[model samples]
Target: MVQSLNSNVCEERVFSNIFQTLSKDVHNFLRYKYGDNLNPKDKVQEAFIKLWDNCKNVSPEKAKSFLFTTANNMMLNEVKHQKVVLKHQQVKPKHYTNETPEFIMEESEYMKKYQRALGNLTEAQREAFLMNRIEGKKHKEIAEELGISRKGVEKRIYGALEKLRKEIDGI
Candidate 1:
């Protein structure tokens, strides 16, 4: 038990040292990706927490890069998601104002169809679609999160969009 405790302490020391070194670059990269929308400091804390939780697998030498990659990915995902929600919210109100009752009903029906089409997609396809179309994520970022190649991400997103457009047209 004492030996185990000592090993844990050693891990903590390594994590602390590495976190201190990488926190700045991680913050800067997150800031660049997410802009002023999210707190870079909070992202650093989250990254450190993840590192601490995964300390067993992480070597001291790789800790800095791991922290940077983890934080950047998390922040990018957050930004992409928030932007999608925001875009939907923004679009809904503007189109409502100039329409008649019939037009409003038609628009709502179209939205329902769109939502249904979106729902019918496979999880990966839907995510790729949203990340590419709604969130504007690059193929590389989507690939990183989805654990696929950049080309795969691009193909999935394209395929999803093509299907969605066809479904929408039928409606």
Candidate 2:
């Protein structure tokens, strides 16, 4: 990127130049590979991160090749992972509860309300509650993750649940 620059890709000016020169091409390449399902921007960033991590080893002449190779390998790995997930899904038994249309509509409406109420909660309360219930983490684990006391995590979760119940159940 930096014309006639030294071999050190780690240099801030050289690295910035490289990013300015290659980011668009890299992003376009990734987007062409995955139009919507996957995040091409994330892939570009990850590729750049790999290049930065190996800056000491990668020469300016070889940086482009290294990035493309790393990105291609990552994409292949993701494709393989998706295939495995699809295979598992195919093998897994499917179950359905065919409730009445009226019931389904009512359930959907209730879910809208529930989502709105959930979003209305304070950020701390929602984070702790979701970490505990959705992630199945213990109060102690949530505390450690949030860098707060167990009591604090408990309080946030309790407050969230109380608000949700009141909003959803009209209690």
Candidate 3:
């Protein structure tokens, strides 16, 4: 019937709108909360699928909350399983025999200083810096992930760099 077809079209449009609005937010939320343990993209996709499946029961206003909660619960279950695996594993140390003792000692000292500096940074600055530098994310990507302006991301990264330089130079 035409009525049934119209209802289906409306439901599809609503689902599409929800996906566009909350997919990135949900992905970033999972990634930020769980760090590297959870695959955020996968979690986002799974959450959206569940939302689509339960579209009749979920309202537009509540879709965001439902997606986030579902993704979080999925991540928590994954973390629990990972914890079990990690408990049974032994971590190995990396060795470099080509470097001189003095060079190695100096490098170690510098790394320690760097870590201390990083630890002293504000949470925002540290998160922005790590995402940009260590994870190879661009300023725009960092901004999106942190839900801030691109300029804000740049400022945080620059501030972190300046603080680190001062800390390391003073050491």
Candidate 4:
């Protein structure tokens, strides 16, 4: 019957639509749950295929739940079979007390040069840089406090950095 044929076509369209819509969401969900080590795309594909095979029993509304459940179970089985290895690394703390006289002189000179460079920056640039670096204010916070746009704050900070780099490099 034409009605039966049309119904079949409609059902296929719904299945295809569900696959396209839920595939990305299902992939992201799996990726978030299992991390980047597992192949989420493969899981998504397998889930959709399972959904297609059982399309007779699943409505379009329940398709999302079915896909997520299938992907989760697949991921769990994969995780269970795999051995988890965690490597611990010890980081050595830096000690600053072992400086030679030449090193101390060089560090002091660098600080003086840095101060000179800060003195050379434009007032706007200097204020923005200090607020960001010294006062530790975010761009948005500095922008609000200075009555400037975020972009303006960013430009000022960038300009200050460029000027300081040039001065410090002796260019």
lDDT values of the candidates? 0.79, 0.85, 0.84, 0.83
TM-score, structure 4 vs. true: 0.43
Leading candidate by TM-score? 2
Q: What would the per-residue lDDT of candidate 4 be over residues 92-135, giving only the tens digit for each residue?
A: 56776788999999889999999999999999999999999999
Greater lDDT among 3 and 4 belongs to 3
The global Cα lDDT (0 to 1) of model 1 is 0.79
TM-score of 3: 0.45
Q: Which tens-of-lDDT digit does each residue in 13-44 have in candidate 1?
A: 55566666677888888888778677888988
Ranking by TM-score: 2, 1, 3, 4
The 10 consecutive residues of candidate 1 with the worst lDDT sum are: 1-10
Worst 10 residues of 4 by lDDT: 1-10
- The candidate with the higher TM-score, 1 or 2, is 2
Candidate 2 deviant stretches above 4 angstroms? 2-5, 94-171
All candidates: CA RMSD in angstroms? 20.3, 14.7, 19.3, 12.6
Worst 10 residues of 2 by lDDT: 1-10
Displacement of the residue 151 alpha carbon in candidate 2, Å: 31
Give the winner by lDDT.
2
- Better candidate number, 1 or 2, judged by lDDT: 2
Error of 2 at 157 (Å): 33
Q: Write candidate 3's Cα lDDT for 53-121 as tens digits.
A: 887776776778889999999998889988887876756666668889999899999899899999999
Q: What is the lDDT of candidate 2?
A: 0.85
User: How many pairs of residues in model 1 come into backbone collision?
Assistant: 0
List clashing residue pairs in candidate 3. none
